[model samples]
Target: MKKVMLIDCCVRGVHSRTLMLAHRWLAEQERDSQVEHLRLYQLNLAPLSAQEVEQRKDTALGEQFAQADEIVVAAPYWDLSFPSILKVYLEHICIAGTTFHYVEDQAVGLCRAKRLVYVSTAGGYVGQRHLGEEYVQTLCQTLFGIPDFVGIRCEGLDLPGNDPEQLVAMVRFG
Candidate 1:
């Protein structure tokens, strides 16, 4: 059985558009695989402090995240980027000799997960602007080295005539 790590960073709980889509995505995956959902908003995850970073050489957070075979991160775009909570979670996971390591001048990933799925919703169009899906994609590929990364984005959510349920259908089945 494959272990999937589901990181839900929706602060709005059930009202979150990204989480709605993510729930459906996870349901589809659950039909075919084993999943362990970890809601970042619900977790008591602490931000990496100066002391934590300095003594992270002995931390176990990275090893915990590395145990997953597939990872699904659901985050909303806030102020053209992900929420601060997700940022803190990333810092905790991106530990040396864990999720990533330094090989000479380059940083490499040590996570066993071969693929990463990023799900997000933005208030406005972020397709070409600095506030869109590209930033998340770049983080997954460049920073995290998750080569197999895919994104499902629904922009302009603040606009009218945008049926979230329909969008969920498209994201889940399309």
Candidate 2:
């Protein structure tokens, strides 16, 4: 079975609409793969300081990212971007010579994952304004060497008259 890493960046945990959708997706994916869930908030990861950057310590987080056969990130949209915790977790894993390396002055990814699925929920209709999705996709392709990038976004959840359950169901089926 393929090793799938599920990165949970949902700030609200069980109360988060994004997480509900993500769980639905994972349930389907689990039928065909081995899923490992990493909850960022529970980890309490801190942003890399200037001192930590210089030291370049070995981290289990980076190793986990590198070893996964596929990655599924569930992050809620916030302030036109994903949460700050997600950014910090990304920093922890995007280590040189681990997740990526330079060859002939060009960066090459060392990650085992061939695909990445980004799941998110937005309060308003974002449409083409998926900045957070784009950022993660770029990192997956350029830095992590995950050639296949997929994004599942459920928008307008917090808006009046918008049915969040129906939106999530659509993604679950389609």
Candidate 3:
């Protein structure tokens, strides 16, 4: 059986739009794949200071992050980007020689997971011209070597009187 790591960074718990979308996507996946939900809002995660970054050059944290078979990150868009907590979590997960390794002028991903999906929602019109998906896709591809990357965004949610069914449809099709 395979493992799926669901990283949920929403503080709204079940009420979060991103979480709702993630659960919807999970329903489309195989049943036997074990799901491990890691909620960032509940974790005692901290940004890696300069000293920690130095020490992370040799640590077990890298090995821990490399163990996931599949990765799904969910977070609501904040200030034109992901939440700060998600960024902190990413720093911890993306370790040198663990999630990625640097070679001669290039970097390679070391994780066993072949695919990764980023689920997000925006309160307002971020515009289709924005690289919200591309930003996340590129990061995963470049740092984790996840050749298969997908980004799903549900935007314009802050508008007055949005339809619930329509929101679900957008997320499902996303």
Best by TM-score: 2
CA lDDT of 19 in candidate 1?
88
Candidate 3 or 2, higher lDDT: 2
RMSD of each: 2.3, 1.4, 2.1
Error of 1 at 8 (Å): 0.6
For model 3, how does the per-residue alpha-carbon lDDT over 1-174 read when each residue is reduced to its tens digit? 888989888999987888998888888898899988988878888999899877777445456557888888887888777788977877786777778889987888888888888888888877755455677678777887878987777887878998643785666543
Off by over 4 Å in 3: 58-61, 129-132, 164-166
For all candidates in order, the CA lDDT equals 0.76, 0.88, 0.79
* Candidate 1's TM-score: 0.85
- Once superposed on the true structure, which residue ranges of model 2 sit more than 4 Å away at CA? none
- TM per model? 0.85, 0.94, 0.88
Point out the worst 10-residue segment of candidate 2 by lDDT. 165-174
Q: By summed lDDT, which 10 consecutive residues of candidate 3 come out lowest? A: 56-65
Measured on C-alpha atoms, candidate 2 has an lDDT of: 0.88
Total backbone collisions for each predicted model: 0, 0, 0
Cα misplacement distance, residue 137 of candidate 2 (Å): 0.9
List, residue by residue over 43-125, the lDDT tens digit for candidate 1. Answer: 68878778887787634556767778888888888888788888788778777777777889788877788888888888777
